[model samples]
Target: MTANNATPPAPPVPSDAVGEGLKAAFRFHPAGVAIITATTDRGPSGLTASSVSSVAIDPAAIMFSVTRATGSAGAILDADSFIVHLIDGEHAELAQNFAVSGAERFTEAQGWTMRETGEPYLPAARVALRCQTLHTVTVGSSVVVIAQVLEVIEGTRGEPVVYLDRAFHSVATA
Candidate 1:
């Protein structure tokens, strides 16, 4: 068949199926865990994120995606700056608290504090990256945020946590 007359390729797989397949595949893939927090006009907001990744080093940049532009995600998007807490297994409960909608967050018992710049900070994190929002891109149902890491706050070190098979797991030195 000629270029313009060539038969069309088979229909793409339905998004629902593709999504399920993607989730299934990722269930076996381990990802480091982080909790992103920010201060908004209303109050403090944050969420657990497994999508955080380093984008650059010299300039110190990081990228993460929020599935919805509402709740803590919305607050983070609107904030001028935020903190990405690199948490360890000891903070798994805190991670779950942030991940769940309407869960009590920033509670005094959670060891949350406000940074001088006003961003919510977690002193218990293995490391906290204070970042200023640099750019954002909307892709499908997710908003991808790229931020410039302004400062790195070191905290207690322990076994790093990872998300895999819908659960938090600790990684120990081999």
Candidate 2:
């Protein structure tokens, strides 16, 4: 309250402070892990993402954000379709591999295979959603992608993998 008995105006927040605050807030928020793969002109490209979320049910739409539209992210943005693999704790190594830059990807040991439709698929994932990109919106340095789920491929079920506090964790069921 001010001397006049009126509410005081809030101080303006710096852009960097807002960004850091958001990062800190999300660091404590648990998010599901997903490996997104696509076929590019160079070869197969993929990356681990924690932002995959369902947007619609009837059209089966989903969305995820990429901080940079390069490497696997660039390939995904350029490609018409891609695969979103919902991974579990058993595939944590695979998720880490994709998350790292210049890491060996799509290796035979990783159980990665190309579907006839041309997108890279990971059979080890608990569930794989074949998606066709519907739109992309640029938000600062990040690109938010909205895709339509074309097919749902079910695989072996297990404890789900989540990311929190900068690490991978497995959720135990009751």
Candidate 3:
């Protein structure tokens, strides 16, 4: 077959590819870690996310995805707004706590507080952005949320937490 008319080889079937292989492929890429938090009737809820990204600067918007049907989904979906926190190396325990299937994410001992709208916020985050959900699209097992940053809260500055090679590392300031 001529190059222009040649049919491309069929894409590899996903089922034929091992899940671990896909995961391992992405393991080489490093991503900044953050925690997404919201408050619902049940209580404060959160999850650790490495998929957070700034979608736009003029509008000051950000986007992140969360697994559908998860505990934090309802809180984030029902609320008009939520908080995204940039975690540092020292907050690995906090990240792991929120990463679990069912864990007490926000305890009184952690000193979490609520905004005027009642959404919970973590005070110790390296940086916090209060965002208003603008749009959402469901893709596969995840819901991608795009939000406009309504407020920015600066916190303790230092090394940032990053996830890579299935482990967490601190970005060096120097």
- What would the TM-scores of all predictions be? 0.89, 0.89, 0.84
lDDT (Cα, tens digit) per residue for candidate 2, span 1-174 = 225536777668558889899999999999999999999787888989999999999899999999775678999998888999998888888899898887788887878888889999888789999999988888789999999999999988878889999899878776
lDDT of 1 by residue, 16-94 (tens): 8898998899899999999999988988888999999999997899999998756889999989889999999999988
In the predicted model 3, the residue pairs found to clash are none
- The 0-to-1 C-alpha lDDT of every candidate, in the order given, reads 0.89, 0.89, 0.82
List residue ranges in candidate 3 displaced over 4 A: 1-13, 16-20
Q: How displaced is residue 109 in candidate 1, in Å?
A: 1.5
lDDT of 3 at 119: 74
Instruction: Rank the models by TM-score, top first.
Output: 2, 1, 3
- As for candidate 1, its clashing pairs are none
Q: Global lDDT for candidate 2?
A: 0.89
